[model samples]
Structure formats: structure tokens, C-alpha cells
Target: MLKFVKHNLETIAGVEIYPIISLSIFFTAFVLFTVWAMTYSKETLNTVSNLPLNDDESLTEKHNF
Candidate 1:
């Protein structure tokens, strides 16, 4: 398997750079997505993360004591 991979690498002149190029592309996409999410995503999503409530509210009808 190692020999086969070595032979293939030799046959493809620029294949060694492919991994670097792909990683760069992936990083660029991730950054773009993060920026878009931060700047253009829903305000509800942004506020939801910092909601005032820290506990769950019961669904039952409110009772007056």
C-alpha cells in the first residue's frame, strides 16, 4: 500500500499541495459562515443565548395562592 501511494504521488505532480489547498478552503468557508452567522443571523438566536430565564417554567395554569 505504501509503495502504491508513493508511485501515485510521483505520478501526480502537484497532488502534495491538494491537502493544503483543501484545508485553506475549509477554513475560509468556516470563517465566512461564522461571520454570516454573527452579523446576519436571527436576533432571536442571539438573544436566546442570553435569555433572562435560567430555569424551566411549568406549563400548568398559573395558580393564585
Candidate 2:
């Protein structure tokens, strides 16, 4: 089965670039997320991290969930 699929793909022109494009997209997203996480503000991180434990009811009400 794998050999058949490989043979079919090999017969198609420009089919090989799919894997390269996929890897490039994944790498770009991974790098962007890493940079965002590294540069994120300490205050915002603390606020979101504590959201589940915060006792103030106003936060929940504002979302209109």
C-alpha cells in the first residue's frame, strides 16, 4: 500500500513540494508562538494564570457566558 501511494505521488509533477510547504508552515507557527510566549507580559500572565482561582464574581458576569 505504501509503495503504491509513493509511486502515484512520484508520477505527479510538483507533488513533492507539499511536504516542504507543510514543514515551513509548522516551523513558522512554532517560532511565532515561541517569541510571543517569551515576550508576554508578567502582569498579563499572572492575571490569566489566576483567573480560575480569583474570587471576584464580576469577571464571570461581564463575559455573559
Candidate 3:
């Protein structure tokens, strides 16, 4: 698979711009997604993975029980 992609990209562009373009796009998207997740994810890492809820409330409860 890699060989085929490399061969085609080199042949088409004379220097393999496809791989560079693909990597740039992937890194940009990954950074954007990480930023979005850190800023906007509803379930924070602290709350979801570390902190315990109060005794009066059950995590499965439909309301603030």
C-alpha cells in the first residue's frame, strides 16, 4: 500500500507532494480537533475520570438526586 502511494505520488508530482499535502492536512485537522475537544467537550477529564460525586447524587440519576 505504501509503495503504491509513494510511486503514484512521485510519478504525478515529480517530487511527492501528495504525501506532504496529506500529512499537513492530517496534522492541521488533529490540532483543530484537540483544541475543540479541550474547549468544548461536555464531560471534562477531571469530572469524568477523577472526582467522585456527592453522596446525595447518583451518577445514574435522571436529575440532581
Expressed as tens digits, the lDDT of each residue in 1-65 for candidate 3 is: 99997777667644657568999999999999999887975665544543355443455363332
Task: Give me the overall lDDT of model 1.
Answer: 0.70
Best by TM-score: 2
Single out the weakest 10-residue window by summed lDDT for candidate 1.
Answer: 56-65
What's model 2's lDDT at 6? 93
Superposed Cα RMSD, model 2? 2.6
Name the regions of candidate 2 deviating beyond 4 angstroms. 58-65
Task: Write one digit per residue (lDDT tens) for candidate 2, span 45-65.
Answer: 776777799898786576543
Q: Between prediction 1 and prediction 3, which has the larger TM-score? A: 1
TM-score of each: 0.50, 0.82, 0.45
Off by over 4 Å in 3: 1-15, 41-65
- All candidates' lDDT scores? 0.70, 0.87, 0.67
2 against 3, candidate with superior TM-score? 2
Off by over 4 Å in 1: 1-3, 41-65
Better of 1 and 2 by lDDT: 2
- Pairs of colliding residues, candidate 1: none
